[model samples]
Target: MSYTFAIIGRPNVGKSTLFNRLVGQKLALVDDTPGVTRDRREGEARLGDLRFTIIDTAGLDEGPKGSLTARMQQQTETAIELADALFFVIDARAGLTPNDRAFADFARRANKPVILLANKSEGKQGEIGAMESYALGLGDPVMISAEHGEGMGELYDAVRELLPEPPEEDEEPEALGELTDEEIAKRPIRVAIVGRPNAGKSTTINHLLGEERLLTSPEAGTTRDSIAVEVVYRGRRFKIFDTAGLRRRSRIEEKLEKLSVADALRAVRFAEVVVLMLDSQTKFEEQDLRIADLIEREGRALVIAVNKWDLVDRQPGQIGALRTEADHWLPQVKGVPIVAMSGLMGEGIERLMKAIEEAYAIWNRRIPTAALNRWFEQAVQTNPPPAVSGRRLKLNYITQTKARPPSFVVFCSRADAVPESYLRYLINSLRSGFDLPGTPVRITLREKANPFAHKRKRPS
Candidate 1:
């Protein structure tokens, strides 16, 4: 297996610079602005002779709980568990700050092997800041200038020290051309792009694949068939389903259109990442949120893309205003990343791909039994399942039944009597507890038979 290394630090710390340097491509969106990256971005990276999977995370900052920054912190923490090692980063030019210390403390708690980096260590001005970083206490800081591509040799040495890549004999070779069946099954990631009729769903998929695999038309509901396309991204093979335009039953009066709507739903059921697109002129229409709600109900990962953004008039407050509006109205899908781009112009298309992969990771996530049970106990304490006929619905235990639209089964005493409202509550609790937002979660209740209440075994 290739060694996975995560880059983590506070905002504007040159983490994206280092990521670009290591990836040998501009995979991450880098700007002077802080927090341009709210979702975790991944790329296949190489440094000198070393090959590894690199994760670029949102910059951390200590603030009010549940802030976007705070949620990004949770994302990084999850990445740490998924990685073989870590590269904790700090801004040498800005010098060490309180937030950096807070993040450093969080990394220390994980007890994972870490290589601390003091970024922006090119000029003599950063020396003092580098000196101040010794206080991180995780170990010596590796000084390097990510922007100038200096100190890469030193970076390679540090990573090789802690977690060496698995030997060639053990390492799974990258598929030569098309993905082999083994490789496909090993990572069966499903991505579904859905939106109201004519939101550029087909256009976006074509942009991502750089091909006209799915039919594109100006007419609403032109794509009556849900089309599936396969593409390999950054060596990871993703099976994408471009769904038909979903509309209300009354609006979709035609028999064929109704079937297309059903096809869109079936596409959601098997998806790991569901991208919900909106036409910029009509962002977040009632139908848009309803589609998002459907994605959430299915437990598939979710991303919102405002298409045809180039045509919109520029305004300073537009981005922030839209994001705030989403947070205020779409609380159920907290931390969902919305990107403004033109599928026609290709502006910010790469960023959308990065966000899609991040959501997919969270969707296929399977928690350990111990942690899940702990969360389950807490949820039960918070709001016990509703009673049926004056007797409490006895939910004995719960376990994930599958992934790729995570489905779980909860063993209970009277499954048939379980109210849909109560089931929804449990599903919401699971979503919040597990850091899964904008994704659908499916929970099925099954009754646990009591042998004592049944008749004795009949004679053969």
Candidate 2:
């Protein structure tokens, strides 16, 4: 039962910078530009001996009703509602602005314990600004530099006073040891929703949550950070990550966009199953293929989601055509699951969830060693490795080293001489024979050492 704190401030007041410092990681995107964080990001924060949950929200600003700016403020307000306390941050170097004063009043109305943070208070100018913050009637501002790591001792003291005292500890139970297979299966699956800009990645997640958990707009690149949320479908829990829309490297010129793209890539690497969302109007594009290739290379289970299905003009064979295109365009994961849905309309959500579970099961599938060797023997006999450099390539045996992408190692003669075409042939055969669809399979070739070579037979 960790207490939660929401950091509230105007734009570019170093809220995200403070979040990164507290979390001890760059989980939230930080940039010089204002309004960089449109979504409220949460992280486990620790200071001295205190531990709690911290949420970094979008800056509070004035906007016309129903505009994007207004929606951003709504997100900040929601963060405020969920928090047990609030950290009201202000830029000490810039001093207090009218917006800061107005938001200070707003924070007061919430009636939560507010800890005023005068950020960027490192120089003489910052001290003057910190003094100015006292006029807002929010109590003495805790002067600190989020970026330069100054005055954290005073900040820690302020937060410590607000937290309740710890309860008495009971006797500890014995260690439970390793978890059973059934217990492990009950854990949440980590899935990442990624695609090109304006692909409705956030909309899909918002639909799943049945709330506007993330900010979505027609404008491309609305999301700049990878935001993770939990969802339970049919008694199965999923920790899904809504990542920034990735774009082609050549087109990304801005420093902020580059950071966003890097954050999305990190999400992919951390996810167990990656759902590549594509706009139905423009499915199977070049960038989509590249993203899929990257997922395969990373050895994660993949599911292709064709979003905005309602917008497409229905055809008799559209579903079948989508399957064919998925197999043809992306042959690496030949039988990858593809679900067509409208994220806005909430259509086909169940099918998408089912496909994700199925893909995850396949990714973790492992075959018995005996069955693997039998299949390996037949596959080799069907199309034996071609003779290389006038020497026969003898494939002795194959064994599955591990699962979670189903990796294998093959001991053979002249491992280096095996052609790339031969390896591809073996990999494809393994996929079809073992029912390993849509999961990346790895096969490593190792040369078998001759027994007589170690003995000095030439001396006789």
Candidate 3:
């Protein structure tokens, strides 16, 4: 488990700067211009002993309901909801404006612990204005100059006091384990949009989010970083990532593009469901398959988005034939969801969301141990483990250890002899019998048979 914190304030107040500071790099676009950062950015942050995820929210501004700024506010609210604590930053030199107070009011009403930060408090002149932070009622202001690199130690102390202990790593089920069907219905679907340069990745993200959180341009590759946004669909929160377009690394020469492509791959690893967005006119490109291969290799749930569908000339049998061919060509990513979407017009986009949700649900599905073993026994009975070097491998049992790309370990006498094709057969069986669709399934063959089931008995 990971603890997360959000740095939020009005525009041009160096929220991005503070974010870059905490994250140890310039992951967020920092500009003096107001609203340069229109979306929330998240990064792995290390604040002293605290190794936690930190979110940089868009600078809030007061605006009318249903307006673009209003949508931005809604995005910020969602961040507050997800985070364990809030770091409300205010410009010390520009002290206690109406907008700052307004944002502070919203933060106060939410009842989360807030650590008030008076940024740009490096000089004696800054100290005079930092004193005015008492008006916000968010507690004693921690002074820091993000650019000049001051007061990080104090910020670390403040965070340690406010936030709860970080969630431990490992796929251990809760003490009250075996979640009911009702609980499954509540888990958020995490989706990552991926493709080559300018495959309408950001456009698709904007359509699903119902607002423009990503900066989209006609340029071939406008998004040079990964941006994550949260949206609620049918009462369930969905964390969506709009990643930088991947270009062939061998062909990519520039310094910045290298970093961007790496960022895109990072997003895929973090995501349970990945949407491989493609231009409908340029369907089934070789590069597309390579991108899909990466997802399959990573063992992630997959959805294929044929974007710009509205622009393409659609014959009745054309799209169907393409999907059929994809199923045949891509065996590793069998049963992958394929949806045609027009990101510009928002047509066919709902199906993409549905496919993503379905894929996510499948990825997180945990097969019961008894049911898994029963299936295992029947599978082995029908097609027994083969003789390798004239020795019949004694396969004992199988158990599904986890989900999020369903993983299983098969306890067998000879782990090395089991061919990849045979493992695929078992994987396919698990997918078909368990009704898990559009998600990667992993099967590991181990020489040891059910170690947890029995204790060793020395010669009696």
Which one wins on lDDT?
A: 2
lDDT value for candidate 1? 0.78
Order of the predicted models by TM-score, top scorer first? 2, 3, 1
Error of 3 at 372 (Å): 3.1
Instruction: Report every candidate's CA lDDT.
Output: 0.78, 0.93, 0.82
- Residue 8 of model 3, lDDT score: 89
Off by over 4 Å in 3: 1-15, 22-149, 152-184, 449-460
Tens-digit lDDT string for candidate 1 (1-460): 6788888888889887898899896545566767655556577787766778888877776556755456666767777887777888898888989988888998888778889998888787687888898988988888899999877878878887865534343366676346764655567477888988998987887887895545466767656545566778777778777777888667877565666678788888877788888899998888888888877776667888899999899899898887887767676676688888999878978888888887776666787777877888788878887777889777788888776566788888888998888877887788778877656677888887787876787899
Model 2, position 52, has a per-residue lDDT of 86
Candidate 3 global TM-score:
0.67
Cα displacement (angstroms), candidate 3, residue 442, comes to: 0.7
Error of 2 at 102 (Å): 1.1
Would you estimate the TM-scores of all the predictions?
A: 0.50, 0.96, 0.67
**Winner by TM-score:** 2
Model 2: per-residue lDDT, tens digit, 211-316?
9999999998889999999999899999999998888889999999999999999999999999999999889899999999999999999999999999998989
Clashing pairs in 3: none
Q: Could you arrange the candidates by lDDT from highest to lowest? A: 2, 3, 1
Error of 3 at 26 (Å): 7.2
Q: List the residue pairs that clash in candidate 2.
A: none
